[model samples]
Target: MISHTAAITIYTKTGERREMAEATPYEEQRRRQVEANKRKLEELQLHHLSAAIREAAAAAKPSLVKKRKARVPLDVADAVMEPVRRSGRLANLPDKPVYREKVPDFGMKIRRTYGSVRRDLTNRVYATDDARSYAISKAEDLEQELDSSFPIFIKPMTQSHVTGGFWLGLPIHFCRKYLPKRDEMITLVDEDDDESDTLYLAMKRGLSAGWRGFAVQQKLVDGDCLVFQLIEQTKFKVYITRASSYYESED
Candidate 1:
């Protein structure tokens, strides 16, 4: 049996009291439960890894068998039956079926824009330092010449390796002139602005005039600089040029 004791000790002229307690059964049980949970989680991870290995082995068996069957035998004749053997291997290879789809060829399209700017106009701003001023000037010029609220995508020109050279500011007007019947909504791909910035400020600075600003790290080609206004979401594609290439058919 354990015995309980109470004592008062004084280290100096002032009196001080101290107490020490033994662990209770409830505390011990809680500690054991926490340890058990940790072990259970480790076991679950091991089980998941084992399952993944088994699934991979099951998927690879058929592919291995097909490759083995396609392997050429060493006993075959070299000169007498060379064309037949080559044709046989070609026949066994997988066929790539072509499907027709109408894809746009926006040669040098300006898709989006990204950057940051200060909130006030009274604040002295320089063209080199102020992103908002640059965007506004570009937008105003495009609007006056094009006569439409064409979608202008905005992005940063800092630290970003622009593969395509800067936009010549003609594609936006051209798209507006040609694709006039489509919806024109400006989308700002603001790489510099965080979620806290107001939509009004972004629009006033000639950035995409809307609340729906998305961030995308586009893979751009070298010597390419995009500048244009999109007519609709369907007309725009994220990383379209880098994703695929087209082959022309002989007429």
Candidate 2:
């Protein structure tokens, strides 16, 4: 007796023809579920709803794109130049004048004035030989006692100093260092504790006006020497050394 059985044909890469059989029960169930989902979507019209949403989104999208602004040209007639700002590092102040020491030039001739006449002091004599020697020794002894701790200057009496103009010019360096820079009345204290007011001429750097009174009161002559010690501002302790000629003339 002959029996019939369901079987599938197979194919090989060697050019043999083949037939595939229907899927198994499990695979068939999965295929039916997929077909059921498709039918549900069709009934609900989900594809048409999605198409409408896409159309609405496209309509709502902004149509204008952002662009850079165009440059505007300026007319020459309307253009204006701005003033330059100065540097902040520069101080807003007047220029300071340079300070220089007033000094006489070299090889320049200096003339001493005695009232109306100009005199040459080159061959001038201060005192006799013995009198000058005594004054020098006394000054040396006094300087040794002070030891330069105080400011001191010596002025030998001249015709211009004791008579005529009666103007006494102190050493330039000493005036610059120890004296006032303006016209003022300075006190002169003698060895007897007597104080005399004398005028300090800042411009000429000399003593004027009242100096004649001090010279006359002290009996100062053309050969006497006076030592000025600055004891205070605008005050001097004056020490005098009279010449031998003065004593002779007095006798």
Pick the lDDT winner.
Answer: 2
lDDT of 1 at 204: 22
RMSD to the true structure for each prediction, in A, is 31.1, 20.8
Query: Candidates' TM-scores?
Result: 0.18, 0.46
In model 1, the runs with Cα more than 4 Å from the true position are 1-118, 128-172, 177-183, 186-208, 211-251
Over 1-251, each residue of candidate 2 has an lDDT whose tens digit, in order, gives: 73233457887899798876657677788889999999999999999999999999999988788777865455643465433447655445434555743333333322222123433446454666667666656665665666376799887777788765778998999999989898777788999998877777888899875677787677676767788899899899998876764446546
Candidate 1 per-residue C-alpha lDDT over 1-251 given as tens digits, one digit per residue, 9 for 90 to 100: 75443344435445555445555777778889999998998978987898999999998876544434564556664434544335665875555555742323333333324322212334322223333344444544444555256554433332222322112122344444444333233333322322211121211222222221122234332222233345454343211111111111112
RMSD (CA, Å), candidate 2 to true, equals 20.8
lDDT for predicted candidate 2 compared with the true structure: 0.72
- lDDT at 173, model 1: 42
Q: Which stretches of candidate 2 lie over 4 Å from their true place?
A: 1-126, 245-251
* C-alpha local distance difference test of each model: 0.37, 0.72
